[model samples]
Target: MGYMPTEMELIELGQNINMNLGGRVDFEDFVELMAPKLLAETAGMIGVKELKDAFKEFDMDGDGEITTEELRQAMNKLMGEHMSRREIDAIVKEADDNGDGTVDFEEFVRMMSR
Candidate 1:
């Protein structure tokens, strides 16, 4: 069953863009890929207080920091219903200019801006 992306698979998947998922997914068979895992299945959402609060859910380390992994987790939770990993990664990269793997709260807030 397809599950958490391996580091290598993540790299390979990141190399190409899937237009269907809005240039986020690379899998030629995302449906087959996500089927058994049921990654795409969800009930619904209630309310999103703010983007920062949404981000905090994955900031396990706290310290007002959010890493790519954390961001991915959050993206999966908040945006999984709409976007794919590649799109999420691209958006995350916009804020993580240093590519240090962490986005402080200030950076987090700044990055989500238009």
Candidate 2:
């Protein structure tokens, strides 16, 4: 899944830009300003929300975080195989950017993005 801002989002952004600029921006200037701004906003949003949601599903304890055991169960269910502890450990280690021995939403997102 991906985050594509709706048409309404774009319209609201344009309205915001117009308001901030006192509604005096010419067409060419508006395009110049909005093009890069929209690109940056969308780029930042891409796959971030989806990855968070995916992490939530793996976080079976409802603790807003995922341990290797939780990930093992989730992957076992998804892949229909009893994955070894070493395999699960490798997955968590790769995703655990902070070396805190667990995967948080940010870590999960970063791993999925890669």
Q: Each model's C-alpha lDDT?
A: 0.56, 0.74
- List the lowest-lDDT window of 10 residues for candidate 2: 34-43
RMSD of each: 15.4, 9.7
Per-residue lDDT of 14-110 in model 2, one digit per residue for the tens? 7977778776777766655555444445446665476557777899988978998998899888778799999989989998867989988766655
Winner by lDDT = 2
User: On a 0 to 1 TM-score scale, where does candidate 1 land against the true structure?
Assistant: 0.42
Clashes of 2: 0
Q: Which tens-of-lDDT digit does each residue in 18-74 have in candidate 1? A: 533556654446644443223222111212356556557868777687766677676
| Residue 63 error, candidate 1, Å | 4.0
TM per prediction: 0.42, 0.57
Off by over 4 Å in 2: 1-48
